[model samples]
Target chain A: MHSQTPTCGSIPPVPARAGIGGKPAHYAELLAARPPLAFVEVHPENYMGEGGPPHAYLEVIAEIYPLSFHGVGMSLGSSGPLDRGHLARWRKLIDRYEPALISEHIAWSRVGEVCLHDLLPLPYTDATLKLVCRHVEEMQLVLGRRILVENPSSYITPKDSAIPEADFMVEVATRTGCGLLLDINNVFVSATNNGFDPRAWLARISGHLVQEIHLAGHATIRSGELELRIDDHGSPVCDDVWDLYRETIARIGPRPTLIEWDTDVPELPVLLGEAARADAAAALSESPHAAVA
Target chain B: MLPLHEFQAAMASYLSSPPGPDVSHHLKSMMRPSLRSVERRLAVYKNNVYARLVDALRDSFPAVERLVGEDFFRYAAVQYVSITPPKSPTLLGYGKDFARFLENFRPRRIFPIFPMSPISSSVTSKPITRQTRFPSASSGASETATACCCIRLPVF
Candidate 1:
């Protein structure tokens, strides 16, 4: 049987700078090189497996750097009850790793036995609000700590969404007492696709509740007259999104930021370069040099 | 006054059968121009959804695409989408059934000689093989000798 550990009472404090998602490919180099960053984020599901190389590498890296557990599964916004087995697996990993931060998306991707494998959007209605709050409460109760909920990028809007997207997020955080991940790329993509100002949307979110930030790449696809920017995460961070990220950090202050690149993964140096860029941006915000400029 | 379920049902229907009668009225109400014009617009969404899923499959299963060529793979993918639409919301987990579908597909059956290979074949030409040989060659030889010695001791 695996040993259980107690969840700490308060949110773990982290450096207000940059981090890279923990991947096995960079395990040795990350340990040996010790890149200049705040912390490392990892998908909790990847470490949910039994004893193997992944766990070994993570063990070594955790010794050197602070860790955050970001979950891609969990389906926290599903209308159905949370998956008991999935929750159990996640709880096990959390107990083992004792990561500083734990997070999941504010969307559902499962119904009954079928797993959609995509971060499906939730309708911004009272009914959905109740459903998601119940799920989040159950998750917190099981893990014994609060999990940050990240906003998702949506392609199509539901016909009967009654509340604004920002209002809905605020309501979830308020009702569930969970912190926000505040993915800037998702904000830019959703606002651009749905005809809304990202800055205004960012303003609506309560800054005090946000605990983490995410930055990533996106691609644009044109269909006749309309242009849609899909959150592909396959290329370099766009200039406008970086500007928005910098601006958001300036308003909200620095949080533990992450650089997520899941598709067409580049070399280790390239990803670290992007993380270094984020570090530079966050530093510039804190730097006395920037105040002079 | 359209309910959310009804709208989703109509979308599912239209995605399954493009320009179907069930969605024509709804599309007209939701979109501008006319019902005919709405048909064109709805077709765009249908294409977008299918294209995204196809590209997703292409990324996950590039070897499958290379074996069948882009045009043929895309045709098969479109058909697959129409027949078995993604029931999950996680786009990353959407293409779980493609490998099984490719196995029995008549079009893919034409290429019977395509071998099962590792994902890193682009860099290395050596084929990976599985073996279950015993660790000790002497033990294997001894077992073989004991079986034949009882029958005949004459041999060079």
Candidate 2:
């Protein structure tokens, strides 16, 4: 039986600056450069397998930089139970690496047995709130640390949603004693697709609970006559999303922000360039003049 | 208020395929902006789900997809989804079955992706057969046991 006991000592926290999505292509470049990144957030599932280059590179990188274990398969918002095996696999990574932050989404991609990898939307209702809180509490208890729940970028708002998206996230954070991931691009994407003000979105959420920030790019697709924005993560962080990020940083103060470029990932330099821009944007919020009373 | 799980089930069904008349009749009424066609609104999620899943297949079976072209690949993806939906939460290893699916798929037989010499996904560099008959270049395959991206396929 695998020991659930936590033997690893405490690791340093992630710096409140900028980080890039830990892609394998850039692993060598990242190790050689060792740029000024607060931490590298990786999808734990990618490295869950046995000894391979993915783990080898991650091990070397972990030794130098703080690692954030961002999970995409916990299915925190599902009405069904969490996958025990998946959680066990994640625990192994966390125990080995002693990552600085652990996070999952506020969306449900599984129901009963069908497991869709897409980060599908969840209705903002008491039922969902209760389901998500139980899973979050259980995950935190098992993982032995509070996990942040991220807001999803949705294409369509489910009909008959009683709670607002931000309000639902705030409630999840409050009840589970968990933190928020606060993906700025999601706020912008969801707002643009569903028609809402993103600034007000930050106002509704409990910002203090926000532990990390995600800045990712999205793609637009045409569906019938309507134009829809999909969270494709295949391009650069748009100019408008960058504007929202600066505002979010100014309000939430500096946090460990990640530049997530999953598809058509350009060269390592391109991602580093994005990370550098994020640092500059967060630095502005850190400026003494930008502080709010 | 609709049952959350029931609503989610209907939504899931809709994402997998266009909603049947019976399924849409009740599910459509529960959504907001009733004035707008519910089908149209639901189309957004439908495209999102299919496009993402299709992309997963495209990534895994790029040769198969490239060989057959985009529309054909999408058709194969649709059939694959109907026959075998993903059982995992992450897309990392979602389309492991597609290679075999393509081989067995009647339409793909004409292209002969797998000519007499079965090119398996072996990780090592050992040649499958010392004596090999190189498949025609038009087949987009080679008889040599080449390890490409950990997938040992006979590629040209």
Predicted model with the maximum TM-score: 2
Categorize the docking of model 2. incorrect
lDDT of 2 by residue, B1-156 (tens): 787788778777766663232336776766665334456556555555555556556545556556668777777777787567667655545666666776677876666454444334331221111111212123122121110001111010
Model 1 chain A: weakest 10-residue lDDT segment is: A1-10
Clashing residue pairs, candidate 1? A116-B88, A116-B89, A116-B90, A117-B90, A117-B91, A118-B89, A118-B90, A118-B91
* TM-scores of the models, in the order given: 0.74, 0.84
Query: Worst lDDT window (10 residues) for model 2 chain B?
Result: B147-156
TM (chain A) per model: 0.93, 0.94
Quantify how close model 2 is to the true structure by its C-alpha RMSD in Å: 7.7
Give the Cα error of residue A85 in candidate 1, in Å: 1.8
Distance from true location, Cα of A41 in model 2, Å: 1.0
Candidate 1 C-alpha lDDT tens digits along B1-156: 344334444555565552232446664454323122344334444554555556556655667778778777777777776677655333424556677676666776567665544223221111111111222122121010000000111010
